[model samples]
Target: MDDFDDDSFNDVLGSMEMPTSPKKPKVQPSTIQPVPAATSTANSSNNTSASITVAKPASNPHSVLVHSKQRGNPILKSIQNVPLEFRDDIVPDYVVGRTSCILFLSLKYHNLNPDYICQRLKALGKMYELRVLLVQVDTPEPHNALKSLTRISLLADLTMMLAWNAEEAGKIIETYKQFEKRPPDLIMERVESNPHQKLVAALTNIKPVNKTDAVTLLQTFGNLGNVITASEERLSQVMGLGPRKAKRLFKTLQEPFLNK
Candidate 1:
């Protein structure tokens, strides 16, 4: 009986399913929350609007930038409004006094050499006040009348005549009479009293040759003494002399030697 019982138990155990451990509860992982598309777009729009507002100009009109380089100097700014004649009248008094010398050269009919006039005036002490006035003589005749007019004009501190017109003689006389109150020293007075002395006096009024030109001319002739002795022909070849000037120079050179 015991053996049968044992066998029956074994058969019963074999027939039954083996006991298994209980299954664990199913578990879920924690989920991350996703942002809303509308909220994200709204934040982006707000940032863009804020940037645009900041870029706008400030309220103050005076805040505008001014370029200093574009501005003009206040002192010189109004100069353009002044007239030329008025401005010229404002020349310094000292300059007028220094340049007060005048030269009146009459070129009515005959052609006068400006170079010769300059040289002659330089010989005179009044060269600084030398001025040239040119007059045209349309008619001939009435020679003595014109001569008288010329004589009167020559009475000025320093005056010279190259050509005279008969018709213009009256005009010259009228002009002289107008300035008669303060008549210039008569150059002719010296001319008549002592012709040779007058020639030297004329030289006193001459504008001196520039130092460089004088030195150069002197050097070319070997010395001032040599230059004085040199013939016009020789002088003509020395840089600044021309044919007309050569003749004048010839006259000048011969004058002193002849007088001596």
Candidate 2:
């Protein structure tokens, strides 16, 4: 019975089957393709078109650059390379259409060279839409600075007068090129004379009194009429003017009033 039982146990172990392990699924290679050269070029071209910007061309050949920032209303789009001769109130109709204007007077009253003036003008032109008009004045001849200034001021934005006589102007023109830098000694700029400037200029003509004294006198007295009516004692008390200058100034103002 022991032999039969041991044989039966061996048979039962042999008849039982072992469990099988599961197999993993295999990964496939990627099917996505590389981009074509033409597709890439097309995409780049689309991007370029989207980012690009266009600018408008100027109305005239003489017009200032399109990118320039305009300030005051300029009389002309751009300054002519050649200067215009100064006539009696000869403002052009074209000047009225511009954004801003500048009058360059190469006159007897101021001594700036044409090149220096042009350089400065161009700088203003580049920075703003400025048109420059240049004129040469004969100093020896009876040229009225005030009249010229008034006429030009009426037509343009600003006026610059070079305080040089015709002879000096000619000398500078002969020696210096229009594109060259200006010499420090040769540079003299005079703005359009207003009432105050005229007053100062007139007072500077007096003996022992200068520009500083004239300004001081004006500051002290307020106006020309006051300066003329001021007592010599009061005028003498000013910083620049002493007793002699005050007396002279008092006398000068009195003469004009007395004459009138």
Candidate 3:
């Protein structure tokens, strides 16, 4: 019986298949796609073409605008408003760099009005530039008048004086001619022999001093004649007098006598 049982078990074991192990899940291999090639040459060429277009300069707008405006406006329109004589006066006698001198004179008178002097100056202006100094002397005389002429002549490139008559003017011209050998100082001295003319000449040279001040100072001191005689101390007491001014007055006073 044992033999039969053992043989039956062995036959069953042999007939049954051995227990199989669990199978691993199958893994499929991954596929990689290929990358596209770079377009570097095409990109570089496009950038170079763009840079060239940006480098060129544009035309100037301001210059074009100015030309357009000038074409629209005519220069003659502005010139038409000026008078013919005035335009002629603006024109120069010579070329741009040339030089010339113009002079003017104003005669003083105690009895005569400024209107007469102004009228004379205006007439004289036809030839030269005339400036009026002043009018009216406390004491009018030929010497003072001549002095005035001489003084102005020294200061100006040219001189002109108001003459009571043509004969008086001729006499002055003759006198000046005689003293022409001497310089201005000697001429002034000779001219001062006439007190009235001396006063005129002194006043004309001492122009930095006002006419009103000259008249007032002379009046306060006495007159031009006596003012010349007064000491510096006496002249210094006047309202505007200072040391320098007092000295100038004293010198002017002595000029006539010294020149004589």
Candidate 4:
């Protein structure tokens, strides 16, 4: 009976008309069988041609659906949003500010390299026209924190790497005391060490003179000799040195030096 049923099925299939183009192989949903572990091992050792294939059912005939999620493109979007003028130019804000920054690292936080720090400061100072001031800060092993801070405060404008505590904060507050304003005469000796001190002193001899006038005098006349020889009219041409001050400068420059 089974042979008769199979023969009739084959006769029906052979009598049907076949399509001109090749059709996809139809897979029976019930025919998917997982390979057994023992069988897989035996197949691998024997190098058999038979292999297990996994097929997912297709919902749409045209497109293959991906299981993974997609991510937004931030870099490309940012580039698109940037202004046209700024697209090619790149400059740091600190370079434009023209302010020198010094890092005052504590011995605890960073290894203190005095020689390296001094060398860098000196080199950068020359390159940047004395605009650099880096210094390392530390309390002496035997001394109190206040004394250390006071000492370092004179050398550095800002502090870094110090532990955050009440004592440290109080020491920082105390450091500012060293920079209190004092009379100009009291700081005269300090200013004397500066190269501009002589020019400043010479300009001070005239009435109502300031530091800017002294700088202008140096820049305009080049040196003290040229300033002394400069006529009142020529001195008046310098910025900030008006006719009255120029006359006073001329008179003071021409006056004979007297023994104290």
TM-score of each: 0.21, 0.29, 0.25, 0.27
Query: Against the true structure, whose TM-score is highest?
Result: 2
Off by over 4 Å in 4: 1-191
Model 1: residues >4 Å from true position, as ranges? 1-213, 257-260
Clash counts for all predictions: 30, 12, 17, 0
TM-score of 4: 0.27
Q: Each candidate: what lDDT?
A: 0.32, 0.40, 0.33, 0.37
**C-alpha lDDT of candidate 1 relative to the true structure:** 0.32
| lDDT digits (tens) for residues 52-147 of candidate 1 | 000112123112111122122121222232211111111110011111212222332112221222222222222223222223333354354345
In the range 82-138, model 3's lDDT, one tens digit per residue, is 211111111111001111111112233311221222222222222222222221122
Tens-place lDDT per residue, model 2, 1-260, is 00123353334333322112231211222322111111101111111111111122223423322111111212111334323222112111112212333333434322222122222222232211334343445455424543544343333334433423334423332222232334665566664369899889888988878999999989988998888878989999999789999888888767754543
Model 4, span 1-260: residue lDDT tens: 00123353344334423322222322223332232111001111121122222223333322221111101211112222111121101110001111222222233222222222222222222111112122223334413433443333334322333434324422332222222233557646554666678667767767766778888898888888898898889999999889988888788888889956
Best by lDDT: 2
Candidate 2 lands at a TM-score of: 0.29
lDDT of 4 at 235: 90
